[model samples]
Target: MGTTFFTPNFQTSPVLQGPKTAYTKPKTREGQAMGNFLIDLSIGSFIHHLYSASNFFKEMVVLKSNEKCIMELSRWLHDRTGAYDWKHASTVVAELEDKRDQHQNIEMRLKSSIRQVLKCNFEQENITSPVELPLADCVVSGLLLDNICKNEDEYMKNLEKIIQLLKPGGQLLLFSSIDKSYMIVSGERFHSFKYSENFVKNAFDKLGLIIDYCAVQRRRSMNECNDYKAIMFTAAHKGE
Candidate 1:
């Protein structure tokens, strides 16, 4: 038998709970833990959707444009593992070794756009281009340094931009850190200004996105998020 976690409804349900599972424990090694975790967890979330085929009416697109995350994920799964199609993802994973690079990872925003276009067999996906999109069914971002939105307005504007991209009935899944900083394997600090729930609430409110759920989870083993007060996962539903 295979591991299954298909949700019947996408109504802001709690997909993951406490006792967060680390995707990988790099243990100071330049590891492939993230690549493996990405392919696996990424698929798990989708397979759950596939199983909920009866409820998944609209098509999906991700928005992760960060260079490090976008590029690395691209090279690993598509060129390297062929993430275009989910067949034998496990097999492809078995062949890779942990070799993540600071520059190798792409931005977190480009991911959804790429996949949206790829659905048509890597066809030209011209959805998220010049001028920005104001309505989408879903948006996903690992707001790693969430603490930096100190100015409040700047943060809300960015959040508003993202919310605008989502459709009224769409969902926005955000993964972020609760602290103001992070330390990558290189011991480099990814710092941002501190933030509050009020700030987050206001951002979503300005964009007319309603909060559906929030979860505090353990950092993926691949992540060295051990120093954070908590890892936040928020599922917001866009309002009309």
Candidate 2:
């Protein structure tokens, strides 16, 4: 098993578009604006989703489970000379919004909003243990739980830990693959925990989170890279 990084196909997947919709489509309560602080704990270093979120959040923090991922993503965000080319992802975002020509501006905005990158271990004894970091108004995670957790029990447990990082009334944006057992990266197969949509909704309900929006995109085409039946995007909020 090798470490999985962002690939062009993964970046262009329909499921990957869920974050933008989660951020932009929902209607907030009257006079209520989006959050000031946002934290992203997605599995890989791919940041295409952040471009949409950068427009709303005042500060963005990226948490990675490993130091290597942290260092790589940090360099990509801060080092201009050796930064990975994110223009393609930006263009996809722009096209989604029908603003193809403004991709450059979008890219710049995402780069500016990122405040820090830190290390996190989701498998800790007390996953919800207090840390020096402040609670975020919103936490965004993509394909993280399924990748890290070994079973459904651990998945739900880790989900609770992630929610602990949010403030009361804060929201959670989650992206997951439905019935996905594995994904191939660079011709290497990596394990992905399989779960159903009902399981996820129930987990949120059990935790007392109110789900605001949900979307599912069934696999429209076949590819040898993965065996996911569908992708699910959910936006839920914790009670105050």
Candidate 3:
């Protein structure tokens, strides 16, 4: 939402701790490291500390649904001037890893790991149909599906599309805002889909995904948006 979700300027912002922590978890890292390629869907502010996977994957492809997001990521990856300030997020990541002084190195690793930035259309059955993105060893998508789809049916279809992008037994990292209908971005409200934990788990089960890890962090206090009650993180693997 206009970089609001990725900025860590505020001390209370969960963007730094929530996602980075989930991504760096020992088991998650092990699964991610099993492959050489990663495909990131809806690459928002998640651009920061991407180095978390630098050691795991030889190359990374970041796919976004909008032109603006793609442009923002490209600027940051190339170290352009107008890119969003990700130092705060990167600092937190360094501290979490007990390498606070090596923050710059971590940031650089993330930048180098990314090989391409591309656009995707989730509404279509094959998100990158004409372009034909390679099926990846891992796919990470955060807060994209619920915010983009209008209804649950569309959400399910798109979820399948994302899974189709992964190789068998490949890992999928997902982050979602639970029970949210709308969020404010740059002073304007954006629509979001609402769903419960059961609904999410049922959908994943129906898709034959093996859930390896799941966690939910409830909102501590209302900050920018009143749309979500909790943040949901899940890691699963595609069936063989």
Q: Which structure among the candidates has the greatest TM-score?
A: 3
TM-score of each: 0.51, 0.82, 0.85
Candidate 3 per-residue lDDT, tens place, 4-64, comes to: 0111122234434452332232223232325678888853656643556665676899888
Local distance difference test values of all predictions, in order: 0.40, 0.75, 0.74
lDDT of 1 by residue, 100-134 (tens): 33212222222322333221111113324543433
lDDT of 2 at 14: 47
RMSD of each: 12.5, 7.2, 6.1
Residue-level error in angstroms, candidate 3, position 17 = 8.4
Is candidate 2 or 3 superior in lDDT? 2
TM-score of 1: 0.51
In candidate 2, which residue pairs get closer than 3 Å at backbone N, Cα or C atoms, i.e. clash? none
Tell me the tens digit of each residue's lDDT in model 2 across 1-240. 111111123233342343222222222232232468888999777787777677678598888887777877877887647766767678767766578899988887888999888778876754434456788888989889988988978988889989988899888889888999998887899998999999899999999889877777677777787788977878888989
What is candidate 1's CA lDDT for residue 153?
Answer: 67
